[model samples]
Target: MSGLGDLVARLLGRSRAPVVVEDPPPTAEQIADAVRDVEARIEGRVPAAVTARVHRITGTVEDMVPRLDRFGVGDRQAYTVVATATSYLPEAVEGYLRLPRDFADRRVVSRGKTSLMLLCDQLDLLAVTLEKISDAVYRADAQALVAHGQFLADTFGQSSLDHPGPGAP
Candidate 1:
């Protein structure tokens, strides 16, 4: 059948295949909801240092959500990174949090805590990386802006461990 004939048939009766549409990227609120939920779940249970890291991580995500639009990603790469970080980290944290603190299986609790610690570290890096990416965006095409690493350190007051160290070549 011709294109016009197919259209007419679909309009009148219907087509067999379903139509698909692209899902809109998550909004800042949706991202904030998951991040904050994880924060609430883990409150006061972890060591003070770990708690501080979680606080910093969640704060960075909160900051990144609104400023995502200003990122120079141009492609969907930026959104994908932010969405994956926010979604995966929170779910993993929630899983760890959901485990009973006094569970009989010491081995299971140990493993869960270990995994949560690792996930929290990864989440920290992810948030810092997003901020660095966004920082680069603001620095783009601007003469006075310093390099990304510098910008990140200046804004966040510290660089990720993965970044070049102060004394490193």
Candidate 2:
């Protein structure tokens, strides 16, 4: 039966396993460039609120690139950084920008909120999420620092407390 199935697949020019082609995950530099492009795309085109939130998100993204190793290439945070740069942030801004300013800011699109209001909410969410990622990265680094400090103290039997100031006897 297995041989018959393989014969049928071969006759149809197919394979036993479906081919899956997934794009390689974006690198830190690619993510950085993408976020920068998003920022540039929205510059002077959006209101102050949108611009401010974008800045907040971009700033965290910039800070996160140097520490991306904390999350590793395949981590969710890494995916998020890439998505925010390549898709999420750009889509949100462009969706709003595509609307006429007066209509976007004035017309209630959903939940009794205008497009501008909705965009602000989206931007705020992105900013907070990126901030949380940044905090997590730093927290990991801080833990590593503490461990290294403890290792030094244990190995040397000395700590900064053991060193006296110049005025000490």
Each prediction's Cα lDDT score? 0.65, 0.87
TM-score of each: 0.58, 0.83
lDDT, candidate 1, 28-112, per-residue tens: 7888887777778778765565577677767767766776776565556466446654676666566656666444213343446
Candidate 2, residues 52-159, lDDT tens digits: the string is 999898888888887777665578987787688889998999899899999999999899999999999999999999888888888888999999999987898866
- Give the lDDT of residue 131 in candidate 1: 64
Highest TM-score among the candidates is held by which one? Answer: 2
Q: What are the per-model numbers of colliding residue pairs?
A: 0, 0
How many residue pairs of model 1 clash at the backbone? 0
